[model samples]
Target chain A: MKSFVVARDLLREAASRRWFLALGLGITLMLVVMGLSLRMDVVDGALAATRLFGKSMNTQIRAADVALRPAFVASSYLIFYGGLLFGVVACADFGPSLLAPGRIEHLLSLPVRRFELVVGTFLGVLALALLGALYGAGGLVLIFGVKTGVFSGRLIVSALLASVTFSAIYGAMLTVAIAARSAALSAASGGALVLLGIVAGERERIAEFFDSGISRTIFRGLTLFLPRVSSLARSAGEIAGSEPVDPAALTSMLLGLVVFGLAALSLGIHLFERKDF
Target chain B: MRRVAWLVAFAALLGLSAFLMSRGDKPKKPERVLKAEFPRHPRDWEEERNRKRRTLPPAAPRPGEDEGIQRKRDPLLVALPVEKGKSSVVFEVAALKESPIGQIWLDCMLEEQAENKRRGRGRDDFKERFGIDLLQDVERIAMSSSKVAVLSVAQGAGRFDKSGWPKRTFGEKGAIWEDTEGRSVFATWGDELVLAGVDVKEIEAAIARLESKSPPQAPPIPDWSAYGDIYGVLSPEELADMLPEEQGEIAARIRAAIDRVDLHVDTSEDVAIVADVNGSNMDDVTDLAKSMGAALSLARAGAEDQGDDRLRELLDYATIKPRDGRFTVDVALPLEVLKQMGPCRKRDAAPSSSQ
Candidate 1:
């Protein structure tokens, strides 16, 4: 497909610009530091205790991987919030850069449709974000696995879930960039959306603050479109900890997030089609 | 063609998300059960703490309220010295008797009493031998590391005439009575406060503490007495010493990990219990918390395998959450689970038996 080819070309462009390499290097450095700093005093296959940065934080008896749960959960929160922020920084300019005067003129002159150009660029940035999440979250899992000898599939799935969460944020970032043509605006909007999504996660609690009226209705309606990122990410973390999770809630969250992302992408397409550049 | 493919993918995700949402767990409905009823912390205690923390206005009742009223309503007849070395346990005997567990305990005791009576033993045996009939006379029991005291409503305070017992009259008003051996000290204040303890000094201190005009000092468990039916505080060092000789290693570990232990049990419509174990620092407490969580998980698993559904359900609600430099092991028993107790079932069947 032309879109796939264009996506591949964008990936090559990112590589040439040292974006992917810098991300990979930074992730590797963080992972190495994390690997070195993390110390687990394990006795008889059970994580007896954990010491983070020379401070003993947790201890356990003959419990198997019970101590690793906090780390697993904390790592999930990091991946969810960390990946969102990282994507905002890394993919913020991808859309604006694509719409640059000379680049846009050349790309538009080619056989690639404008929608394809938008979709391809979005997919390309998403792929980059996914790779970054895999490296950062996946590397931590591998390192902890080596140290504790408990290779958790839950951690692996959490990394992928985190990547999926970013797609929603990245979609909004793409829309903001395509509209404003400013990376700063794009990044700020994406960050704001993440914050709003967190608030939306507690929509039920917030509704309790207001009376049952139009104002409450308006607040509830405004949150309907926002992804329940915090709850979804918390559930993802729960999965890793072997805590019970409501599959229906998680599935709804995933579906809601993907729908929000696609809606934003559609809006970007509509804006792109009408642009007279 | 590309748009169609994208649409299909989006549709698939939507379907999957819906399916997942459908699989979400429904909220569980909690069952009601009997609860312990007892005197709780006065509003002033928490207000005082909050004021200390935030420098706010005093939350206690205005000081205009007279001393006579406050003294009469005070929950404990003994003022326990909540110091570093001493451990204190106070049972609200009246409240316990009102609770489901206490009712069962009473039933068992009554059954034992019936058996004793069937053997030609009378109420005099319990009264003469034990020097107290807790079922008929006692209102509350207070125990310290050094002494055990009972408050009774019965008459004739000096009825116990054990031979070779030297009686001494002490206290400012000579209201306190004591034995030379300090084995038993008894005192009567007004009509209700019949206090006794092993140590005359402790008994005097408790009497003076109770009789004093100043407001009682804050206890180790500030909120528990106000909220819980049964509550107690334990010096971790003393508790470790009390451990069985065979459990030397576990005792050592407990001593190493804990500095103080606060226990509160609420057996109302639900069984809500908390054992707050404070350690030397956050690190020690956190370690204890992890171990507690693991132990709970193991216990739950064992209970499940043994088909102890009630225990498994109760343990499922048990958790170890870290507090400020301490860890609280919380267990909430559902009413349904509490009903599973043999005594509770027997009590339910009691009316049927009478019919």
Candidate 2:
């Protein structure tokens, strides 16, 4: 209950920021532009023609769902990557602001436990990420659905996956801010983790560069614990395309990301408990 | 003590999550099956030669020719005349004619010919002059370093009228026909084989080789490698020579680093072209493979930027895989892409007889 109060306080703080307003305006402008310029000619569930800004895009007739798959995939990837980048930038200061000297003292004086504060901040950032993803991905899905009459639920799922991915990234950022009390450091660490996660996704292929010896083994060991961020994004795009995906593998990956985020949040709480402000 | 315990528990949880994440295996790289091997001399050369001799009937010796030689029935492979260090390409025309893309190509060719005829450029009508339908008569066409041999169907050879050709010099097994300018030579052996080359002597040598009058040279491409609708081997020099002048630097680099490239094309459904690039040094081959892959990615990006969706779609099927001192580059055009991009689209729109 105390964590919920802290979370509400964080949300209230976020609602007053210019960053939230800017994100909302950006998505609205994009939706308006897309709705005005994109045109499709559908005949009997087949796409006969497509025009963007009055320029012919495709003349070959194909099933509407098949023709629009690339658009969905591109949107899913944009939401996945663009959302993570935006979250990293927007939520970077949240952790440092929460851990500021006066703010930390006031929060500690409340009934909220130190661990509750960390968990609340994490949940607050997660909610913000989910909201951003839904605004971007959902608006695009609605536009495409209204334009082509082919509604897909996969893009919504992709938006949720992007939010979960941001949670994992934000957990690390929170830990960094708790330890260093610097927004720059927090943002830098988050960016670095995102890059490392991408590399880890292609670890097996990159491992081929090293000769079969200690160097290769060390490379593999270092990347073993990193989250597969790019793989998750790719799977999201595949789902958006209605491609076959292994359900068991996707479940394991989702579970891994959640556990990893919790573990990072726990580490942040441990740091917060040890620090004397 | 509590802080230390918390750190330990975090580490344990990190390890557990990592284990769970690793369970979702990465898609394994497709295994490359090297169907073609580097061309080498057959070790059982003498034994195979003797066995071939024992199976053939003896031919009557000409005044200048050696005895105990025989005219063997041509099985298309025996007439290739490919020599050591030379390049060769064989097209299985009959098999290609049955494929969807092949039919489109033939229709396009026939349409062009008909258009040319309508324009009064009436010289290239093989059906009118020789009574041979290119779509149905030719079985396979093999082109080597200096010779081109077309193996006709059983009934195709009888359709040709030698009287219509230019001046000819009659030989014991075949005749070498000379063009009006005397710059080119065409030879016909038995009934089903027709060969063309720059020099009459080279054409005669090929006929002699087919007749077993001369010792057989090593096959430039092994018989087993010739499995697809089109198969060939390009020597390093040949590869360099085939490149355009704009790609001079690339041609030079290929000549220096690459040894040979074996090519095979399957046209059953999707048109797939696989080139096995072999090099002497493993690092050079790996670098070459990486360069090719990078080039493809750049091209794809350029196509996307230019909004050339057809080019982008075609490039999406290209892939390069390097394994053990060699690499394979594969480009496949799916049937749907072919139907969209092929000449058949215009043909389908119009009332056409070939359909």
Candidate 3:
């Protein structure tokens, strides 16, 4: 009950921020453009793959199949719903104000304990993240219905989940912000990590060099803490109505994110509780 | 209107992806259904039908009309003597430059053929060389001097020798290759002897023909007492049926026998048979002695290198070094300098190699 009030306060504070609105609007516009581009590319790929290898493709399944496909999910919501935002300038405001204002102390002065403050802020960020997730997910649902005449709850939810996963990455960044002595450092660290994740995900050639056993072990460990960030998008793809996502990858990533999320949250609470305001 | 256009484009792409995703496996192809617009070309269609019939001796339907891969287990055996023929073992002794053995094989083959003065081999010596082939260096730079690992994916090159061709991952990433037309190329790369290709079919055919095992040709027919000793033994009837050239090689053997390479083989008399793994066909050892008119070391892809124990032994026997965390093997020969002193000089080993 104590946590709920903090959550509500955190949510209200974030909702009142113009920066949050700007972030929300920016993300939606990007999704709108991205969704358009992906729709074309995924279709082009599908046609080419089908045509070249068409003789091998049984056309009989065309009319029978009616769910969101993996290819479409991959194309439409690459980074949108996984709760990850590429434009992170919103958090750029975390330069000095966060620490300079001694907001943690002010919050502690309130009825809230140190842990409550962290929890409340996290909840607030999450609320914002969910809104972002909805924007992205809703777009995907509209696209899927418009494209395939298939209204699927699974795909919309999957897109939502993917958006949420992205949000976790941002959430982790926000935690870094909370710990920083200066908001600039926190924002920088957050932006850099996000950029690193995006770059690492895309860079296959560089990844190939580190594709040794040790690297795989590290990758598995990372997935544990950032389960939502890592597996959310994948789950969205899998759970999208009509087709089931690949169970192995989804399960593994889910396991990874859960372990990591719980650990990071626990660590955050401990740090916030122990820190000097 | 612009919004509608964007929507339509998105919709089109979405529709296309869904359509592509829904295609079931095994869609109909249009090749096998023959619609012959044959107006007065009855003969051609008749010929085509006849050809198809001949190819399908047992009445199997053509591919489009048939389902999935043909699972016919071919019991084709190639473990015996083929037709009687004289195999001129073209010598490509390019031990120096560690010349990629394939290039030396080709060079020696061309040299031997040049001596015979013939042209128009399977690959054109004329129609624009596959230009300063970077791949040519693949053997010398990639395999020579240090122990290098090759990774080729295409491997079905050497003759199947009637039985299916064996697979060797001589570090190449793909299947080994053997160009037909009976020409194996051996070239010099700095000092590494390397091979790029050899007439795998010609040599396999040659080996198959060896089943005629006439009166044993050379005195020291590599001691078959141990591993792979006389795989093909000719009975007395087989001896009598031997080709005349086999008889001559047999006659040459009787006069003076070459000793086992390990058993103090008289280097004074016979061309030294160095089991040098410095040939292009290192990956495809089936074409060993065939490149040289005189069968030197009967080549096989690390044929002698077998089990883990043997591989370990090779690592032991050869000078071991490391490159990119892999062993680079070099089995040096003291007798190699002797190769330079005589008429048996390999082209790459020769003071003046044919450019």
Of candidate 2 chain B, the 10-residue stretch with the lowest lDDT total is B33-42
lDDT (10s digit) by residue, model 3, range A1-277: 5767876775666667787777677767866764554331112111111211223231111111121254456644554433454424554343233345666457567786665555555555556666666666677666645644444566556655554444445445555665665556656765665555544333333445566788866753442222333224434554653343555545544444433333444455555555566
Q: Write the per-residue lDDT of candidate 3 for residues B1-355, one digit (tens) a residue.
A: 5324433443443344223222211111322221111111124543453243222112233546443533221001111122232111111112222332334334555465554434543232221232222322221111211111111111222222332234332221222323343244322111222233354443333222222223223211122211110011122223324435644553343222211111111122221122211212221221211222112111111223444333332222222122221212223222333333333455556556543
C-alpha-based local distance difference test score of model 2: 0.76
Please compute DockQ, using alpha carbons, for every candidate against the native two-chain complex.
0.09, 0.16, 0.03
Give per-residue lDDT, candidate 3, residue B89.
15
Q: Give the CAPRI class of candidate 2.
A: incorrect
Give the C-alpha miss distance for residue B147 in model 1, angstroms: 18
Cα lDDT tens digits for candidate 1, B279-348: 7878876765665565566666678689987776676666566667777766676656655465556657
The TM-scores of chain A alone, one per candidate, are 0.91, 0.97, 0.65
Write one digit per residue (lDDT tens) for candidate 2, span B231-256.
77888788888877865766776788
Following a full C-alpha superposition, what root-mean-square deviation does model 1 have from the true structure? Answer: 11.1
- Please give fnat for model 2: 0.41
CA-only RMSD, every prediction: 11.1, 18.0, 26.3
Residues A1-277 of candidate 1: C-alpha lDDT, one tens digit per residue? 7878778887888887665687778889988987888888654444556677888776333334555777788888888787888777767888899999999999999998998998898888778777777777779778888987767788777878888778877887888898999999999998998898887777777877989999899987776567676777777788877676766667767777776677677767767877888
- Alpha-carbon interface RMSD for all candidates, in angstroms: 7.4, 12.3, 23.9
Instruction: Give the alpha-carbon lDDT of every model.
Output: 0.67, 0.76, 0.36
